[model samples]
Target: MPRPPRGAILAVLAAAQFTVMLATSIVNVALPQIRAGVGLSDSATTWVVNAYGLAFGALLLAGGRAADLLGRRRVLLAGLGVFGSASAAAALAASPGVLIAVRAVQGAGAAAVAPAALALALGLHPPGPARSRALAVWGAVSGAGGAAGVVLGGVLTRAWGWPWIFHAVAIGSFAVLTATAACVPAAARTERARFDLIGTAVSALALTALVWGVASARRAGWTDPAVLAAFAAAAVLVVAFLRIERSAAVPLVPPRLFAAREVAVGNLLTALFGSVWIALFFFLPLYQQQVLGEDPLTTGLGQLPLAAANMLGASLAPALVRRVGSRTALLAALLTEATGMLWLSRIGAHGSFFTDVLGPSALVGLGLSVAFVQLTGLSVAAVTGPDAGLAGGLVNTTRQVGGAVGLAVLATVAGTVTSHAAGHQPPLEALTAGYRTAFALGAAILAGTAALAALLVRRTPADGPAHAPAPQPAASGRP
Candidate 1:
């Protein structure tokens, strides 16, 4: 077959990426409707989101490695099949158990799709101005997907019902899959290294346990025995995974990857970035609905400003990086986001969206989009060859795990504060107080992230003399 145009390949990959991120946030606005449709208890409704996250986070590393060994195009196709099929099933699900189960299956497929799609994207252009431009598009689409999910979810649920949200994803997935199959070229596997089965199992279990424990703590209380047990199991499994990696001739994750300052510091910041990024979407809608008394569709439409600002930031990132350098640009972006969070901390119980939400949301969206693009570029700056998939997987894993941990911690803090303030304030006032505290704390975290990046991320591929040389690509496979 003739090779597809680079633009066509990018379009397919971007569609796949957008679909993955959309699934993550689309359910947020529709949770109430979902509960009504499936007869889910409050706790079970939360699982409708958590199950997908848990599976996606746990299986990412394995999926990335699979893409490297089996072939990027192959894994991408297979993932699309699974993800699309599961999404269709989720749309038709009537029982809570079936819905939750299919959501996990959807996540499992996402794990495979995310890294492979990213690796292929990176391979389309060499590391330089071209790659930076490509990454800008990636970041814009990714950031837009999360914000758009809310908009689409509200409109779809209000107009057609919650099932249509899943139906939309299913339809998009199949369309992207078809385009990918027709356009993306298949590459032969290059490396013949032994698969690290033990490492894969241990790492997946450890991640799943850690995320589950943190997620449960919001409802179960941090001191609960089951949560404690889950944490303990996670710790042990992590240790075992480390030991297995050290000894395995073909490690799932080579220990040396962390030695590169770019990978280490970049991932650290990505974690912080992810933590706030996810929580912002999670809480903002609640504030609109619970405190401001907006309906779901109205709340979703209100997010349009933030989505616009996010895309604007993404479009500007490459030029900013070129002008100011990655480190300086990153610090500026982080501080911008922190300032937004601080502004958000002043939200009032009786506030209007224009007075309380718009400005801060725009600031947060702009900062988050630029930061995501920079961090993604930084994380994979020194990676090449088959390990591109691994790098993609690792960066994504950190983001997801960080989001889980951050949401859990922030939720706990807010709940405790709300409970304490309920005696002195009206219910709406009490809720606002909780949200204020969480936003303030989130700002502090972003401030800390900026300080850390200032100290640690000394150079990037875009930084001329200080940049490390990327390894040459292998002879047979896609880089």
Candidate 2:
């Protein structure tokens, strides 16, 4: 049978990815409403967010392997069904416990969907300009979806109700699920490749512990016994996982996957990018709400420029890559990001959105688009066949881990600085000082990432012979 159209396949897959990306940010805007509706305490309110992060980060590796072994199309369908159902259930949840549980389930589904969608996209498109263009679209959608989530969440919650956010997500997810079932081609499956249960268990536990520890650090200090114990447990579990992978017949994560320079460097860059970018997205809104006295709707509207610029940057990435090569493109992107961070660091007690927010947001968004697109291409550059899913999963896993850590660290720093300055300065001045400190630190981190990317990820040839795409042994079957 002939393969499905690449464009159609990418559209469906990108939509699936868009849903996953949207989930990560949408609830953030609705958190205040959720807290009030569910009568949640301040501490309990945070779990509504972290529960999703914990499950998504912990299960990604296993989810990736499942996609390869169980067939990407099959796994994708399962994930969508789970996510859609969870979203619907979450919409009607009356209690905080119910909502948090459903959110965790939604994250679990996203963990499965993310790697499979990426692998399927890679499988459908051959390497070259076609693949480059496809990746650009993928990157743009993912980045824009993330930014749009905050805006959409605000609109839906304000115009309709907070539950409408979940309702909309459910509707969108199921629509994509139906379209994917009809459009995406199925991948060939191998019976010989089995899930590594031991590796999965240990690695999942390690990641869960690590993420849980980091997520709780802001509430419970880093030195708290619970935090220390969680980290210690994670370390031990990681050692065990490495040992198991070394001996297992079919390891969950093959060491050979990291042997590629592009894969290793891409993951490292993504981690650093996630650290700063996620924190920026989180805190910028806080500044808007607290200092500027803007409502959620205005906050979302303020981010529109960033989202638009991000899409523009993604669309321009392929051309940039061809002109400057991937390494140079990444370097330029990082420098842009650092510059944007420095600009945003100047935000003060008295500031206008155009004067203080727009230019910096655009710069940061454009930089994010370029870096993410190029890095994603690099991450899967030489990988082929079943390993494609794993490569995709590793990239996302590292980024999520970095985001978890960054959120904790950045929040603590901003809070500490604000609290310290409150004793000596006016409230607005103290808050601005805290935000400026975070932005400055973020700029420094991006600079460091640029240096590391330059040193580690080499440039692709400006002119090189075309290489054929890697072959997949699986059968291609359309619904």
lDDT of 2: 0.85
Candidate 2: regions farther than 4 A off? 1-3, 463-479
> Which residue pairs of candidate 1 clash?
none
Best-performing candidate as measured by TM-score: 1
Stretches of candidate 1 exceeding 4 Å from the true structure: 189-191, 459-476
TM-score of 2: 0.96
Q: What range of 10 consecutive residues in model 1 has the weakest lDDT sum?
A: 460-469
lDDT of 1 by residue, 1-479 (tens): 78988988998898999999999999999999999999999899999999999999999999888877778888899999999999999999999999999999999999999999998988886677677778888888898899899999999999999999999999999999999989998765465678889999999999999999999999999999999999999999999998999999989998766767789878888998888888998999999999999888998898899989999998988888877777787889999999999999999999999999999999998998888888898888887666888888898999999999999999999999999999999999999999999999999999999999889887544443112345444443753
- The CA lDDT of each predicted structure is 0.89, 0.85
How well does each candidate superpose onto the true structure, as a TM-score? Answer: 0.97, 0.96
